[model samples]
Target: MDSMQNAPSTEDTQRTSQPAPVLALLPETGVSYIRHAWQDMLSGMKLARLGATLGWLDIKLRYRGSILGPFWLTASTAVMVAAMGVLYAYLMNMDVHKYLPFLTFSLVLWGFASGTLQDGCTTFTSASGLIHSARMPYSLHVLRATVRNLLTVAHNIPVVVVVFLWFAVVPAWSWTMPAACALWVFDSFMATFLLGILGTRFRDVPPIVASTLQILFFVTPILWAPELMKTGQDWLLLDPFFPLMEILRTPFTGDIVNAAIWPAALGWSAVLTVVTFALFARMRARLAYWV
Candidate 1:
């Protein structure tokens, strides 16, 4: 009775003057969770530091046991680039130096782009150990595979350095590289966000994506030059791989990228990202059962 009588206290009366917590009634937590599960998709989403760090760890772990550890990645990349560069570059009648950077960057970018999808098909199922037992975010699993591939790219970096040195051509020298890398990083995460959700649903998706990326590896200017094709100016600018890599290559080679690629590359990345996020948002609730 005494406590009830004192319920309306002087301190409480003073606190009542403060503002209440802001909650958007239209956007509830459930909707937010779904949104959070897939955010960076459509056009422009913030780069996820968490996703990137997780990718780096995956790389360290993948090559942890060797005497050279990750250097093995360096060595292996060198050999593949050299061998392929010699045979393919010669046949195309292009100078080895001119062709080398293109190939190295091609393979490395492919590593980043393909890494996410290749592993994503198994993102949920592979993490069955964690999926069922642990309560970690699903993004962490995607991080594992993407990071592992990034390590592959990291290993490939020195090869790029050596190629530039050997060719003695500063294909790109100034601000372009950072911009390209920035673009690559963003697109990579976008790829991860969407692929992570899709990978969980379709068991056969991984192999299918792997095979497709293999075909694209040949067609997408990795082993060959886009200019080598008969397709005209529009195709070169519009090639699926060119815009993405040119962003990187221009910076590396110090060439100005066509103004059109700015929107074309980023626009597609954004569109794909948004579509993936929307699908994931709609379907995330069912992931547990599907996995």
Candidate 2:
């Protein structure tokens, strides 16, 4: 009886020790999201794991068959390169030798950029069944989308490798293709993280993004080297994705890291990460309803 009585007093003491009630945060604009976005992402970590697991399971189930189940990733890309090589080269009036590397690397990066954006749009809606049934936190769905894109990228990696091998475009010992790939991965996931939120609410976003990327492909200098033109018009490489192409194309050119690009490339990734997290935070509250 005495202990029970003391427990109530202790609870009261603890309650009184707590801080006073706080004001609700006014969810502001672009910057507001960044402030809370990291917190939300950290909070959603456990849920994200659940989503990633589900995505992995989905991949396994979908690809269950035959000897080299996922190795077909490489084979399929090789076939595309061969088919498109002759076709695109002739159409673009590009030298097949020079244009092949551009086509190959651009396609690989496109797969990363395009895949992340598209997958992010449907990240929440597609998992409606899981979201409803499991009563899981929503961020998990975002993670699952990112994870699935990763798996798709992994499967598609064989394509990049086979293309490089077929063309004998191996990196020199000093060059860091792996580092470039890691940079691209960081950019790709960040792309998904920001767009994933907007995509959930706006149904038209995915198709719009698709058309944009298609247009971007032609405009981004994938089929022809900007430097190869008769005149010095290399300024056209200013497209945002121009860096993506540069990062992907450098290794094949057997060039050392461009001293000028080092700061620019890293700067872009840092800016993207910061801004994207801000957007994610801004949109988090509306995410569940949007989905």
Candidate 3:
């Protein structure tokens, strides 16, 4: 009886030892999120090779039983370009030679960019099983998705070559080709990381994004050239995706890339990188639990 009376109460112990359980779910501060983002970036760089291999493996498995394998993507793209080139050129009253090359490059590059972003929305959640079982950098998943689509893009380049040769079109080499591609990668990575995190939590974002992309495909200058709309040049510039697309497409088509595109694309990449990193950092700790 005396020992029981002298013992500290369970309520007292619980009250003194911990904060309220609800407080645990509260969002982290800005500084903490920034720190998490920085660590993820460093960790991701350290594991880039692993990500690349995984990405390659993914490509191989994706076409494991197929005869043509990855080339199937190229063939499919070629057929679509052929059909669209004929139909759209007639509708728009543009020269077939001019329209075909422009359409070919636009569609190919768009596939790379759009595919990366769409797959990115599933980055973490799709790999939730592995993420839960293993201890590795989460950013590696984003890298793998990006690299996988990049390989797919590389495989599709032959189609572009065939188009160029058939039409006797010689595309000029520009310094902006590599520059724009580099910036685009940065934009793609951040988008994947950001959307992946949100997707895991919301569960609705993926479908929403898919729907948005479908709508965007029609509105984006994929089927029609921006130069075709001279009165709406300013409106075309307002299309956030066009500037990014044009950087690569212009260089490939031997057109002078707009000077404004460089700064615009760079600025877009920088902003997204910063914002996505911070969001990733803030949510990094909760991913495993949420998934």
lDDT string for model 3 (105-191, tens) is 888888887888788888998899889999888889989888888898998899899999998887678677788778778788789
Better of 1 and 3 by lDDT: 3
State the lDDT of candidate 2 residue by residue for 88-195, as single tens digits: 889878777667766777676677677787787777778767756765655566667677778876876666666667667756544467777788767776777767
Q: What TM-score do all the candidates reach, one by one?
A: 0.77, 0.74, 0.87
lDDT on C-alpha atoms for all candidate structures? 0.70, 0.70, 0.85
Error (Å) of candidate 3 at residue 200 is: 0.8
Worst 10 residues of 3 by lDDT: 19-28
Report lDDT (Cα) of residue 197, candidate 1. Answer: 69
Residue-level lDDT of model 1, residues 178-235, one tens digit each, is 7767777666655775666677777667788889888877766677866676757576
Better of 1 and 2 by TM-score: 1
Off by over 4 Å in 3: 1-29
